[model samples]
Target: MTEQRQDPILIVGGGMAGALLALLLRHHGASAVTLVESHPLTLPDEPPLTPSFDARSTALSAGTLSVLDELGLAEAIREHAAAIDTVHVSRRSRLGITRLRASEEGVPALGAVVENRWLGFVLLRALYADAAIQVLAPERLSAIRRLADGYEATLESGRTLTTPLLIAADGAKSRTREWLGVSARDSDTGHDAMIANLSLASDHQGIAYERFLNDGPLALLPLPDRRFGLVWTGPRDQVDAWMEMESGALLKQLQQQCPAEAPRITGIGERQRYPLILTHACAQAVPFGVVVGNAAHTLHPVAGQGFNLTVRDLVQLACTVGGASAPGKLSLLQQYVQRREQDQALISQASRWVPEMFRVQQPLFAHSRQLGLVAMDILPGLRQGFARRAMGL
Candidate 1:
């Protein structure tokens, strides 16, 4: 096949991570970036008849907020997001709150809770608004080949293009990663997470709660209205039962499971379920490519850190490539991997271990878990340090 040369960086997957990275690169004066998305660009004409819901919602840490501010997407997000001023963490059977207060961290808000779709819309808006960026939606990648100086990709529509760099943000099942021969290990947690939207009787008051039950972690995140985003993890059979319940019954069950003094579930919205899986790529960077977002690491949604971690990957990559004359150079890619290797390892390890900490039936293990929470609460310096590290500050 004849080779078709291109002048811009090529990004596969127009999801949050890819769109954000494209915007960041454009902001840093990297022109001619092209994003290819398998999904169509137009928004669905009809909203959910019951309640609008997204499978995921991201908790933007303070440092993440700063990064978004630099990218000019912060204001757009703030305009649509719910500011979480407090995080209340506790055991399901216990009555005491373990962590609280955003003020203690010297930030106006601990984080912002925004629907995954809203974030995507904002990024798409920014991407389309930029004249230097080109987006191809409803397009699929068929194959990729490494060239002498760059890479060449073929679209399902029989179009071929070449660029210096190929970014794989397609997701955990990334085709680019597979084509490039990157290996990843997958772990099945034998659990599933059910996410939905519900309107509570009482206002959430911008509070985010993580209730650790014997089954798994249950999160209720405040949304724009009196509604809250719910992420509940448990055994597959149990989650299947919950998903099968009627709207009213499901709401009642949720209210009982959650510790907040919320009234009966007034309304229930769209509900969806996904199997929980933890996956980590053997390597995050290659000679002419790198994988970000779910493609790089897929974590349990218990901590709401999956997307946030992916965004952090983009931030680190941008910082590494900003000053380079050739961003796709082997030396630059190696440096990017070195700079982000530790942080990625730390997050992956911590995410894998934290859930295990709560699985212990022994008294000593339970006591240690409680003590760890207490330490995180009382030690302002430690909490602040964690917050900073998460934000990639």
Candidate 2:
């Protein structure tokens, strides 16, 4: 019988973040890395339908795309992604509109949007191709015992293994984080998001639209083949009602709410909805275990900052621990959390603030919000700063 060998690093979760972290670690020459996931890994011909990489789509910031380029996965992604040449922000029945353009920012493109399934497929292919990564799906980390050097983990199948480093990329309701005694603060945004693919009557021309309506913000992100990925947010009951509406009625409602500049909504695909909640872990690292991705922080989708921020965290963490002699050192993990504190705080605040700022129906606040959008348009420096942040620069 072949004996099970101890791995230097063990990552729990095989979603986008977890899988990408394994790839990044391998890219940085980290060997003997084992990834444990509860979900079954999909076949090469089938796109993964994991919770993180289901029918939903994601906007990849320029910074993230750059990281992918370094990892040599950008070309595969670019084939399916639609560039974001401009981001147009407007308020319903308001007098102000702001457009942040990639040309003005002196970049090729601000970002791009790709289906999460394809992204997952790319990562899975890379993981399987790398001999250094040991992917164990259809498996679960049942328990962990803290050791002086790291952790001793037991799997559901009664297999035992030890790793010097443990990472919790299991997502927002991370069992690994809980096992490590990390507490999370979850704030319900009082809103739910309905997402689906949209077919437009006209070309989107690579323009992403953010229209703030009375109920909630609606984002129509450009996608290939004259389609857009829709993130429509509102109260749970309202969204549920919309979910039940006939396609034609729903499209009509979207047309009424969307900005006139956006392409007409031609058709809608299967829709899914979930409550919007902002969650932040009280602490990011514990002794030898570290929390990453949605396990550490889950932000609102209003600004599309959630996954992008997670990618940044993964990159920094990989750079910090990859190829290190003591990969699971507590001090090193703490340092990784420290370096990410500012970025995490800022993006979380912004994600929360955007929706609240627009939710207020008061006259003075409305006027101020309108003026703010106008200012962002007229002031090059102001818009540039915002653009840079949004692009993850």
Candidate 3:
């Protein structure tokens, strides 16, 4: 390979997806990578600590964990993580309930939960330690112009660099996607997700719960220290009211909402809310640039599938680009997107459809859902298939 083959593959937006992509590229034998983040990047001796009750978290599906393990990052992440051995899903005020156990699935755990800060810390630490990677933080993309063979990009600091490939992992509302003339189609789910960490009276026992109520889905993901990360989605007014309630009142309301099998909620922490929207980029690859992560698709959090899907996309992208003579070749990029179409489409559709399916108030829909849940629980093959999909396998 000539020096040109090692030319920096510029990546904009050094958040979780961008940072992870840089490392995955290197892991796939890409020699040079550049990561750009508008926010300052630093590696503190210790991961930033948040009050146990206040930190937000993400559940890493089993397949995602395997990818990280291949990158040699799982050990450090496991230190601050919580294992999810079982997932119990049910509908409130309904007779249907089902549990997916890692034991049945023959995996160590269905997934793991880690605070967002810690995950970022692990990714950034690895990126910073890699001599083959270049970090350009506290900087933003000013402009990008496409050339016949590559792209020339200017940073906010007025520095110019050229690369055959540019990646947009900026986020759901990615400006880079816009600069590349890619548009996103966003569908409002007519609900807001209120998130908080709950102090459980008893341990979570490695169980995560997804309970569908009259309003929306309530996801309780186990976190370390006997706390559960809560994502309660409902009407805006309801979420606002719950956000304003005193801790005791909020805990009582949560207790009422949760299943009888759920752990007791002793306290609730700082609350944050965001509207639920399903966003999909009209195109994932354009010329010298390709979109990934939230930039490519932002799914409903009902299934905790967004980041896990992004990880799979990044892994596929690394494999595709690593084997190409020209990383930004339009044909290669298109091939990558085409190969990922089925998985991405399935997961994205399921994420949007799950809440909508449960939201149907008709008696017929209700009975069908009950039958479906019951069938899934009683049938080993059906339950295993559902479990595998949820695990991002």
Q: Which prediction has the highest lDDT against the true structure?
A: 2
Per residue, candidate 3 scores C-alpha lDDT tens digits across 123-197 of 888998999899997789999999887899999999999988999989888999999889999988778999988
TM-score of 3: 0.96
lDDT-best of 1 and 3: 3
Worst 10-residue lDDT window for candidate 2 reads: 3-12
Candidate 2 residue lDDT tens string, 1-393: 995444669999999899999999878768778999888887699988888889888999999999999999999999999999999999999989999999999999999999999999999998898888888997988999988888999999999988888999999999999988899999997889999999998999999999998888999999999999999999999998999999999999899999888889989999999788878899988888899988889888986899899889999899988877778888988888899999999999989888889989999999999999999999999999999999999
1 or 2, which is superior by TM-score?
2
- By TM-score, the candidates rank as 2, 3, 1
lDDT on C-alpha atoms for all candidate structures: 0.78, 0.91, 0.89
C-alpha positional error of residue 140 in candidate 2 after TM-score superposition, expressed in Å: 1.0
lDDT of 3 at 217: 96
**Model 2 spans > 4 angstroms off:** 1-6
